[model samples]
Target: MARSGNEQVSYRRAPNFLTANEPEKRLDIRLSYKSFRALEEQALTLYGISPVEYSATDSRVTIYTAPTALHGYSAVNLQQAISFAVYNILVQHQKQELFERIVAVGESTYSSVNDQGRRSTKTPDAGLSYYYDGGTVLTIIMEVGASEGYTHLNADILLWMNEFHCRTAILFYNKECPKFKFPGNADTYSINDRPALEHTWFGTLDTAVLEVFKRDQNTDTCKMVVQGGSLDIGLTIGDVLPPNEDAIQDIRGERVHLRINFVRNMLASGSHDTAVSRFNHFIGED
Candidate 1:
């Protein structure tokens, strides 16, 4: 209800399928980006604070608040899934030019002008960039929603596309239930303690819907790239690569994919193969 910075956001959001939290930071407060940037360094290096994002247009700095260790698992897997695919493509081609042009910028902050022409800064869970003449030309930003619903997360996807001029964004909409109470500073929430309810992205990361978005294409629309369970198919090699004409076409395009089954395992269910802890299943389902 109160104004913080220049914008006041709602405490709730709607669900969208094509996508896509840390935690909901209490609102009605303001902090300068410069101050945040200073804290961000110490927070990241010393406290392990991560997946923090905010725009200079506003004073609200968001932390992908970890409700459980599962959030961290989901974040890491999503980042590696894309990073490895892009890295493998570069390695297979073994092109020196490609290596120099493409930079693997994993979980880094972005400083750019906002749609309103004000300078803004934010960070993605993971990303890669294509450089020409020493500056980024094309960028791929990956965002995973855990404690948030569609509207909040999709807005992020659009920010990269509309304001940052970023292309090829990936979204993972987690299907974990959110009925459990958020574990406050007093204690750490565990996945087993998470309520077993209907699948929803309101505040958890279970299995997820994988999708891709292109900046040049309709900003509001996205195509599903992968799903969960045995039906899952990993994303194509070209899907992760830059869409620019100069980018790799990959003669083995259809032949290669970033195996969704492998990458999504840790997010899908409890397993010693990926990790020991995971969210419980639905009330009636297996």
Candidate 2:
């Protein structure tokens, strides 16, 4: 349970609302690959991590060696670094359009508004989102790992995406595997432009690839599954593990935590005010 002033709210039943006062302040963090790397470096340094131990060659950075499982800063904080880094990269690269279009709000704030009217504020351990240039469209989601500190809110994430009409959602877990029910469509489109069905996954670092595959088994409903490791190894040329039974423990250990950083993507294109207005218009907010 989370407290707001004198009100006590159940963490599971809170409402999600947009609390940005100017709407302009909402798009502060624009994300880009460059910025993401910088943030990763910053996080490593802050956490006493060494670049020598871990290499962030590109957008999809990973740990080279394994560490003691489950030893690192708060999962929430690590993910926040990812969210901020992604934003900084986008803004610094003058990828302002992406930055302005996408925004990062903490999971706690998101939960408060999601339930609305009926309750007080509730904070999720960690949460994030990427909105379309018009703000009306929520394009991406990042749900950081919380298997140990809190209950995994996989179902709630799905509910929020469906409710908000978000196109893509990503769930990052620390010490556990998350299952999704992805429903596919026969109609194909641009990689990023496809319908909401394709962009959902329970991302993890313990896996071989930077990302895991959660392909939808059905089209009419939200039915999907995870292939093997938390990532699809075929996409990247990096070395991938062949599926060890202790994979989760190996990655969740202390060393790997120090060896890795995360990335989030944000997008937008226009002036700050224009971006704000466009976002407001897209979200249908007065």
Candidate 3:
């Protein structure tokens, strides 16, 4: 019996003709295990730490500092640790709360028109969103690293803020990077009836400042007000940057995974209260 080498393998088009022929456009996006795991690996490898730094509890993942690494833990690391921990907690709670998955986007899903009616898309560094059955809603976006001149950055945040009507953006900075210094921390500045950018700082570089983005379209203004710093910014930012090949090698020692079980458990455990708390937490009202 002779079998054609290529014929042996059967190739057929997608089962659904409508969806198969449809143009591939970005819609309500979701995360694949590959994408999520890659990001976690990237984060750990880029940050000059081992994944082992994260310790998983029943419903939370706690991050610990590597014993040999100097520079002490920084706010950046602390924020990352908390985020990772909560991520796992959320995962475990997904079934109960209907929070199926979490995702990260490379850009913001928004567009705008100028006074002349010219349209343009708004983008962010990296976005984190939670997925439900019907669709996906943005949960958080991490603007990986930024230098000075973040004034325009507020506009992008404004677009997201207006769309979701929620806050909670996390921005990270390299320890040696230059950033604006406000006279005080978490001060709100207003412009044209909307919030303008606020100023904040960490003790050193590699800080992650959680900002609340507020936009007032009626007044045509956007503001990003700083909230607080995390625990491990110093250690990560100071040592890890431009994450070179050597840096990745140093980070391969351990694997750090987010334990979002607790957060998810809480969400799944209840509804009215959990929903309210989540919405409030996103807006920083709670």
Candidate 4:
């Protein structure tokens, strides 16, 4: 239980909520930063739920329950694929200094908000950060909206870019699982609801899009430079570099691509095609 000024709120273990595979849980209390951390601790130490995420914003808190086993497999494998590619590029260029500082912080909690409710806090689904000058900056973020909408995903990237002040954010809006049923815990998406689009280059593009939000240091703004079903583009060194350091050791212009084909293979569990197909069936079940 936590105290919020005049009101008292309790954090109970809603096992049914987790069993439902729900995405997020909202709290009306405007928890202080200390209270928020306290809630995270109790949820972890007392409840044995360590891999959860919490978001406190707009005088409320949203606790992101751990996803399904399938989601866990895909999210970890996908993040590993991207981070490995990036780290490999740094190794090739022998950027040992910057490379060491650059690390993949998967689902780590960090905040831009304070005790006074001046800002917000988040536990990124998967993210990357760099520590320098006694300060940690969220560099690259990856958010998988398994059950979220376009507007939420769209706003998330900017929050990462402007609020947490990250360099880039890769938003993967899951158009696969389009519906959410509460008490029953069933997903319903008619096959005719949102038909897939056939792209000339990618053969067929699933509604599930891959977008990259790059922030411009000069203007403190961001843009969706890469958006598609199958992303074949690479992240320029500028995209992954630490803040305020554009050119690094004569290797200013470098690009590292997270090959979608490679990611597809990585996400495919032990059984190869069968595993991949089964995974998709679970996500797109009507």
Query: lDDT of all the models against the reference?
Result: 0.48, 0.31, 0.32, 0.50
For 1-286, candidate 1 gives per-residue lDDT tens digits of 0113232222122011001222233211122334334434443434333434322112122222223344456566666655555566667777435655656676676778656887777677666666665567546777766534665567778877877778667776664444333222212323554442332223444456666776656754544444333222334445445555355664425323456576657665422211222222111111
What TM-score, over all chains together, does every model reach?
A: 0.55, 0.30, 0.32, 0.55
Model 2 weakest lDDT span, ten residues long: 233-242
Clash pairs (backbone) in predicted model 4: none
Model 3 residue 133 CA deviation (Å) reads 4.0
- Write one digit per residue (lDDT tens) for candidate 2, span 118-205: 4433333334444443443333344433232223335434544454433334444444233221123212323334223343322232
The lDDT leader among the candidates is 4
Model 1 scores a TM of 0.55
Q: Candidate 1 or 4, higher lDDT?
A: 4
Task: Output the better candidate (1/2) by lDDT.
Answer: 1
Model 4 TM: 0.55
User: Model 4, 1-286: lDDT tens per residue?
Assistant: 1122222233344433333334333222333345555655554444344434421211121233224333455556657766676677777877656766677788676657655777556666777777677876667787765444566656667767776777787766543322322212113423343322221101121345556677774323322233343344445666766747643635655655666566556434422332333224333422
Candidate 1 accuracy as lDDT: 0.48
